[model samples]
Target: MSTGGGAHAAGLIRLLQSADFARAFTLAALGTGFASLLIGRTAGSVTLVTIVIALDVVGAAILFARRDELTLLRFAPTSLLAFLAWTLASTFWSFDRASTLRGWFELLAWGLLAIVIAHVRDTLQTVRALGDVMRWMLAISLGVEILSGILLDIPFPFLGVAGDIAFGGPIQGIFGTRNMLGFVAVMALITFTIEWLSQSISLRLSIFSLTLAALLAVLSASPTVLVIAVAVGAATLALALVRRSAPEHRRTTHTAIGAVVATVLIVCWFLRHLIIRLLDAASDFSIRADLWNEILDWVRPRPVQGWGWHGPWLRGDDASAPYPLNVINFTLDDRHASALNSFFDVLIQVGWGGLLLFGGMSVVAVVRSWLVAGERRSIVHAWTPLMLVALLVDSMFESFTLTGLGWMMLVVCAVRAGQSRSWRERIRDLAEGAPGGHGSGSSQDPLSGAR
Candidate 1:
């Protein structure tokens, strides 16, 4: 190659490795990852996947160029890598290797996006990026709902707009379902709340953002939204109590709160029927129960390794598709993308072992995030734990956490949590201080102060 050409290529690489470029890439990645559903529904799966692949490729190039600035030990959480490895390993025994391989690629795509954001941005910056993305996506969703339900007075079947906003709907918005919209709204509520507490955004804008999220959450009419709202509210209060306590007493307080929460969960489980009736979700629960039962029947045979990771159970409402999930739906005379339960989805896909890994990853991330949130001085630290709580709570009723924006958010939270409090960080710290240690203490701080 000519000297000029070489210099030009080197300059481009340097540009890609710059901090400014990293920040912009993080924001763009968040926007694209969060809008996966809308993109898929509006354009097509092929288009959505193509965009993800393109973004992943660019993110990879940037990360590669900036490799020297990153600490290899802290690249990602061990639990997350284990879960991903198990997911990839499932392909060997998959009923459809090609489909499983594609699903794994999608998983890696989102995981890579989350990892890039974690490395490039601190908690407050990440929160701001998400807040911006949520504002636009939520606004677009509401606008689409308004356009279809009012101006056009017609359903946008392609985008999953049912024109139900005129009736004060159960509106699906740009998300494919009312439940998904509700889930995103809950996430928006959390992000907006953090943005408000941190004062990263304007007071007027925060209020407006909060109002938008609350309105869509209500209009979406998802029962899980109500449950998630209550859970997050309780968590906020609990976190506040923990934060205000004396540092020495926080551990005791944590134990007491955990005990109370455990007791309440047990009681709620026993009274679940009454709660279901109160939420007017009996019908929805019944439908989900049927799907769960069918999924269990399929899971029993492959209880060890599962039927393998097939992601979203295959597209289309075709009964003759011969896909396992499609077959289950056909048997139940229902049409759904997932089993409607994240745990069940994991169990049926990667079996009990995969379920354990997924659960461990979630539990560890939540614990780490929760402890850090209570201990940290900045309120911004609370965002990760609160978001994880909402994701896990909603996972019980909807399998949204298994794919799309839900999965991306889950990965981001887990990565952030792991960065803040993990054995890897502790080991690196020790190594940095050891005699003759070459460690430069260059590991990125996930909570590098509030913005």
Candidate 2:
């Protein structure tokens, strides 16, 4: 009996540490975070929390089991850790300690999940996992839209879907809003494109996935989608050029691309009104502008340290809520869930200090990823930089990056980027007396799958 019990325990431990198990867990975590709104709405917040807690427990166990092989130095990005630490520190000064603590805990939960996936799987594996999740998510979203709009011809209030597909939709699908759906579709498009490029999935499936993503992205009718599409398309072209350039000329290519992007952005900013009208995003921008104005009014009072890190605005319980969010909502005469801008959201939450930390984290992550992608020979290397571009550009329009799936993706990309190029690697190489460290070898290119 004792032998049997020991054998069973050993089996369980081995199973948990297996590569297949890690991939599966990655899929589950991505799916949960991406589908959080649908889960929360359908199964209730309690169920959503329960699922997250369960995943957290499993992630902790897996990390613990693998602790011998993993070092703290290489665990996460320094900037990411600093930002998290600042957010945690904000609890002391937060308007509502309870809410702040909850927000911080949720933030840690998603971050942990991302960290685990980053440690367990390489970039290509992570991308493939994301591809699987996005495919299912996009398919189900289309199915739901069809059911609500074409077949039933009624709104799915439970899912926040307005059955608008029949009328050339602004369909929400399961993401709770057109903007969210559009965001997911864009992410899917990126993932599917990577999958196709990497030859990870069948050509037929890749084609279907791309078609599905494009279809939903259009049907969502999100103005943000247009901007994201243009940014991502331009980025794709730039990355392709960088990849094809000779090693010596790559730096020149990078500089030229940077200058062009900057000039384009400046031009867009100056012609913002014309572009807004062209995209029919005037009303959306106007609404966002008004809310941003109100948010600035709140941010002025707590410029340095802000009102503490209460993520999404507290809903339903005004009395128990923090000062500025409830106050802002009342003042605006609208129940604004967030500042609608991630930078502003961070600024309002943890103040200037937090915003700086957040900005540093983003910039470092993107720069590292971009450099790695440019130097690496594999197509999969391009995924991180492209996704980072999408996320950062989208952050200007939505607060999604502060929490949930967006936050997870950001952390995963940052960790992957750091793994490929970081101070930690330099220090380790110096310690081992290996000058210049390993240079673009197979060891360094762990993410370079199949190629």
| Cα lDDT computed for each candidate against the true fold | 0.86, 0.88
**Considering only N, C-alpha and C atoms within 3 Å, which residue pairs clash in candidate 2?**
none
Candidate 2 has what TM-score? 0.95
Alpha-carbon lDDT of model 1: 0.86
lDDT of 1 by residue, 177-227 (tens): 999899899999999999999999999999999999999999999989999
lDDT of 2 by residue, 1-451 (tens): 9999999988988877788889889999999998998898889889999999999999999898777767666689899999999999999998689899989999999999999999888888888999999988888999999999999988999899999999999999889889989988998899899899889999999999999999999999999998998999999999889888999999899999989999999999999999999999989899899888987888888898899998888543344337788787777687778888999999988999999999999999988888888887888888998899889989999998988899999999998888788877778778899887642335445433431
Give candidate 2 regions above 4 Å deviation: 1-5, 315-321, 438-451
Could you tell me the lDDT of residue 12 within candidate 2? 81
Top TM-score hit: 2
**Deviation of model 2 at 184, angstroms:** 0.7
In candidate 2, position 105 carries an lDDT of 93
The candidate scoring highest on lDDT is 2
